[model samples]
Target: MTVHTGAPRWWRATTGIAVPCLVAAACGVMLWSSAAPVVDFVYFMLAGWALVLLGIAWLVLVVIGWFRYRTVRRTLLAPAVVAPAFVLVTAALVVVQAPFRLGFLVSKPALADAAADCTYSLEHRRIGVYSVRSTREFDGGCLFFTQGGLIDSVGIAYLPEGVPHLGAPRHDGDIGYDHIGGDWYRFVERF
Candidate 1:
């Protein structure tokens, strides 16, 4: 059996802690700055910078440990672990956050108008019309919208004719989409 020892142990522990923190920091930067419609470029830049930092940290540790212990490289220097770990974490992050990010972008146009509707009548749960057309499947509470400052949420329950463009209302206590003239629209929590 092999075990991490001496500097290699410290190096591995430090990298393990830092890698997650760097990833989380990158996600934070992306979410916080991504509200702007034009923030895609900036978000990419921030992500790239974060990746560079991660790579630098990893490389520095590998090189230092490789020169110091020599045996460390044989055990820890596996591209299979590094590459697959990176891909898995990245995929997980994207899959988890894609809905919220897409929802934010889609609703940005209606934000101002939605905010305005909240002041005069705040008693109503219904906001306004919402439209959704997706090539991907959505569950209950998938899409959210805001109108006149009022916010509402809906989701796609069914797709008739196997068409993503055509969705039907659901009774699962969630809003669904309707197809009208090849377009999807949600109105007042109904399709």
Candidate 2:
């Protein structure tokens, strides 16, 4: 009777990298969506399902490798690390409010273009992290940016004169705004 120590080097390299990378990519998709959104909201759905399915697959593989082969597979080790690391990274992102800041950084170029042209209100325009469903409403108003969602939305706004930052985000009713810097703001429309 012989006991398998672990997967071969080739299997470890290929399968090891593929599964863990895919799971890590799923984590990345979630981070990006939260940090900087995209036009299609379906990506959130797809990414969520991918994490669930991949988790199940990983469990099955781990169980099989352990019970049948009586060996802990080296490929299975990466996810154990990735899952915990993802949680820590997520916490850090929230603490620093990375989403609000990242949104501005990612959309800076487009926001500048929008600022320069008060009349450039185009519907469904996409050039950065998120798509603008209606630059029209914000036209001649403030930052002239919008990432309108069917239910919720995000965009850059401008704080009126003397509406000082006070070092915190301000909220009103169903809408909330955060000061990105200077006179610029990032606003979110709640559903």
Candidate 3:
């Protein structure tokens, strides 16, 4: 085996210690930032791609170091493996979580209002008539309105066959039709 003796002690120490630490720190920062609501989806996508590329490059460096330097191979190995793995995992998570976060970001205001109305109607049981037609964001459905203009219960159908339109009770006491694949309105609900 060929020995590499010209390398500086500081260089070996920095590569062995500092690089891995920096990579870990960067991964932590990326993970923490990705969870922030204010960050845009586009930013996440871009950052994810960038991290993936960086990981790939770091992996290449690790392979080259393994072949070229006997003394420093161990020094270069840990960061080379761990950094890329951490970065790739973080990138994947950020990409996967983007859609749900974007959905919340773009959710229609009408859905929020309808959900609030449904909650109030259900809790008070004084419903009269309540309904919300499905939008691109939320499923279309109707709720039963009791005598006191409060909602009694809610039923929503996901992606109904027809185009989305406002639906009201056909008659004063009508609770409206129930459909499948939709969620029942709840007081505290997530998107």
The candidate maximizing lDDT is 2
Candidate 1, pairs of clashing residues: 113-148, 114-147, 114-148, 114-149, 115-148, 115-149, 116-148, 117-148
- For every model shown, the clashing-pair count is 8, 0, 11
lDDT per residue, candidate 3, 105-170, as tens digits? 443244445545443232432111223222223334433221111233233322334323334445
Q: Cα lDDT of model 1 overall? A: 0.43
Off by over 4 Å in 3: 1-39, 71-79, 95-191
Evaluate model 3: give its TM-score: 0.37
Tens-digit lDDT track of model 1 for 25-80: 66555553433212344565767687677767777766666666554654364531
Instruction: Write the candidate numbers in order of decreasing lDDT.
Output: 2, 1, 3
Model 2 Cα lDDT, one tens digit per residue, 1-191? 56576645544443456666887787676666665432225665677788788778766666656665564644345644565466467557745767647876887777666655545455676656656655542423454445433455666665445233333234443545666677666666565
Candidate 2 clashing pairs?
none
Error of 3 at 22 (Å): 4.8
Error of 1 at 153 (Å): 25
For model 3, the run of ten residues with the poorest summed lDDT: 126-135
Taking all chains together, each candidate's TM-score versus the true structure is 0.39, 0.65, 0.37
Error of 3 at 83 (Å): 0.3
